[model samples]
Target: MSTRLRCLLAASAVALTAACGVGDQAGSNTVTMTVWTSNQAQLDLLNRLADDFSAQHDGADVRIQSVPQADYTTKISVRLAGGDAPDLGWLGAPDAVGMAASGQLADVGPALRNDPEYRFDDFVPAAFTNWRGGDAVYGVPFSTSPFFVIYNKDAFATANLPEPAELAARGDWTWDRLAGLARDLQPSLPRGHFVFQSNEGSVYGPLPVSWPTLDPLLRAHGAGFYDPQTKRCTLDSPAAAEAVGTFHRMAFDDRTAVPPGAQADFYAGNAAMTITQLSRLSQLEGAEFDYGIAPLPGGPGGQPHVTGQAGLVVFEQAPHKELATELLKYLTSEKAVRELAEFYPPARTSVLADAPEIYRDSRLSEQAVKDILVPGITEGHAFQYPRTWPEIKTTAQPVFDQLWSPGADVGSVLGRLCGEVGPLLKQAE
Candidate 1:
């Protein structure tokens, strides 16, 4: 076994031995549970839930220890191996497959199946599936966020460009169309005032856009990054080439995208559109200009897709398993989900149906779900598996960075990158 895998197993062994059942054998009224999480905003929300849980359960106390985003995975792995793992800690959904293979988590399906209040079927299938290894469910999804396209309505009207909704319905709003619009508007606006981010490292504008939009386009074009049946990597296919080509042209060749070095362009009203998450809408309050949210446009494949991150998982060996599961159940309820939907999009279909006011003002969230996230789930989803995703982070970034440079050959650069990285992805298997 690999060093990392060995470490994970050792940690799981300790966790499994340290705790026996859900509660203390003496049946103590008070049960203490430990939690680990990354996002401060989410931690706050969970804190509120903890308060509510403690109140309802009479003598239960929940203690939370937050880990910084950068250190979460490493810390959890070490803790699990060393037999010092916290009960009910957060686990990354991307690592679900690999972790489940390590046999660290308790099978939660049987417990949840017997509880009517939990309503396990209400969650988005993708989120639920990602938390389960097979018949067993190791974790319950607390939150899910999908990427969407946000645009300036006034700018679109000024340029006489069609609203994204109309264009999407007409099947006329392709990536090329959006790029062309940016190119057309570029001449009228100041250089720094155009599309704020066309290319950047995985961040605010360009990087987020590529994950949710461009990556999906590859899937629509019939590219398979990994062959599930064969358990192999195939990221160098023609579809991948085409998808990267489009992004290269849009960010560099057409000069439609603003460089990240010019951050002032977006806040200064020079840029027109951006790719962002719905949770980020809070930052746009009291903007000087009128902006609108819309779903990202689709490709020739006739589908839009998005990349997302899943939140909150309970540890299998948690001492207070019953209470933790109860708290988790409450966390996913309509009331709790609606509260979270105020900041982040809820992963439950019921919450989406019940909470109209949350997304009422932000048409972006509504449209993006209908256009991007749902389609991605229904058609096929794509994501970098946790074990080998580091390869993509290291290799694909330089290629993307070069695309923003003047006179760079995006195709040759990407072709070389895929060739080099494909082997690495295969090695992880």
Candidate 2:
């Protein structure tokens, strides 16, 4: 057997032994969970929670391991497949679906339902949809962050252009207007600076990363990869074409956006604006330039707010399944959720209602958070995903690559993409 397979077999043996009561025994009195999040602020908060949980239980201790985001899903899958899974971990919407479907995740419903003090009903009903598979709840959403435009106030002033907030207030903040503003501002920026930065600065490769940057634009124009119910690709529609074409013009024709390989960050004042979650405001803690947050510009279809959701799940193969479930509950409880709100926007109705007070000490002003951030979360649609998302994303990568080509036909490229991925989408159904 290969080394990886051997390692998996060895891990499986360990798990089997643990299952038979050789590990996490009464005398052991400790639980260690691996979680995917490298952000120090997030980690610090989680560690504090772990400490609290430990304090409540006599002779019990909890340890948290931080895993890098890029490798988290793959690493978790390998560990699970190899029979060496963490007690619990954070899962993005797409990966959560796959893990739940494969039966790698433990159903957290009974534990949650049995805990009356947990206030399960307090959570936004919509936030739970992604974590549900049949009757089993595989995860508990912790972050329901919506995308917004983070702009450099200095850049807007230097360009003598109205900020996105001003345009939004006047109901003139549309994608077309944003594009025009970006183009107009490009001339005024210092050399090497640009107007807009998509999530993570490029969409040339990595479908998972690229899709977030593209999804909002598509939704803005009444387009989507597929209908969640119909399972039919909609990228070939006129609205999608217009949306893609507009972005194409910005990236290649107008040269307004940071091109495929170029680098610019809104937080660094290297670019005028970027589409991201408010969580990124942590990066601006000591930023040299003045910055402001604004809702995403509306498109032809009107404002289609998009959110990115992430959750906590316990692995089915976990040695301490019961303990992990309790941890998940504790981590998502009202108190924990409120504390996490400093970095992650909470999905709880009560917390969201008091968002202005909850985020009182946030980097963005209370007014800015209330005006731009709160509405986006309350009104945003979570990014859609299918069980076959990972496969479909890989398949569509090359097709999306055509968009980077100068003079590329947006309609043709997208139509071809639909043709290639249509079968995959159907299979996912």
Candidate 3:
């Protein structure tokens, strides 16, 4: 066994032993969970919820282990493969599908159905779409955030460019327009400043991680990762080529977007605009420059909203399945959901209806939440995630690498990508 596997197994042994003792009636029990974020505010909120859950149940406690976002999915996979899985954890959209396919996740449908007060129906269908597999629901979505364009208002003014929100209001905001504006703003920017930052500054952290950045562009051009009905790769399609080609020009030809291995922070006022989710609003607190949030620009296909989701799930191998299920229920309960809305946008219709009030604590204005955040969640399609994503991502990375080069043929690179990953996608079906 690999050293990583051995370490995971050792960690699992300890966690599993603690979990086994959780069900004993006479003794105190602890349920352990793994989560990707170590943000103090988020951690404090989760810890508070865990404390409340513990208080409500006799002799029960909750322990949460923090994992870095980049390494989260790999660590979870290792733990599961090593038979040392945490009872519960957060799963990104792609990881949820992969885990569900491997039978490593427990179906929480029965537990959800049993809790009448939980009002499972209150959750928007799109929130849980990625977590569904056949007759079972592998997870409950906790974060159903949608990608939006955050622009530096001061930068736009200084560049003599129309604000994105104003353009959006006039129904003139389109991907072509955004690209042109980015190019126009490039020369006006400070020497090292950029016009745009692809999602998370394009460090190529992981192929799956790029979906938030790439999916909106693809969907805008009427393309997607694959066709849902046929389960075939669509990256080679004409629309996909056009969409990617536009971005390539922005990165290489126009020099507006931050290129591969280059860095420019939108929050730090280094870029004119960026595409990201609402949760990142916290990063803008006490900002040095004025920023404004707007919905993604429309493309040739018209306006297409793409949402990114993360779900809370129970592992099939969890020793305390019942306890873990209970915790999931409590965490997603209406009151808890409302509290969590401070960070993660809630999918509950009631919460969405009260968005103005619920979002008051956020950095975004009520209008921004209602106009951008709420609509994005309700109308957006979840990012596409195939069960064979890990393998497909590995196969496509080098091909993606080629796209970043100057004057690269995006169509040909994308075609080669489809040729390589198509079989894997088909197998997933």
Top lDDT prediction, candidate number: 3
lDDT of 2 by residue, 288-360 (tens): 8888777887787888777889999898988778787888999999999999887789988888888989888
- Is candidate 1 or 2 superior in TM-score? 2
- Candidate 1's residue-wise lDDT over 226-303, tens digit each? 664454555556766676666666666666665435454343356777766665666576677777665555666655
- Which ranking of candidates, highest TM-score first? 3, 2, 1
TM-score of each: 0.76, 0.90, 0.92
lDDT of 3 by residue, 107-219 (tens): 99988977799998998887877888776889998889989999999988987889999999999898899889888889999988899898888635567777778888888
RMSD per model, one decimal: 7.3, 5.3, 4.7
Q: What C-alpha lDDT do the candidate models reach, one value each?
A: 0.59, 0.79, 0.82
> lDDT score, residue 33, model 1?
36
After superposing candidate 1, which stretches have Cα over 4 Å from the reference? Answer: 1-45, 74-78, 95-106, 196-210, 220-224, 260-268, 316-319, 361-429
Candidate 3 residues lying further than 4 Å off, grouped into runs, are 1-28, 203-205
Ranking by lDDT: 3, 2, 1
Ten contiguous residues with the weakest lDDT in model 3: 1-10
Of models 1 and 2, which has the larger lDDT?
2
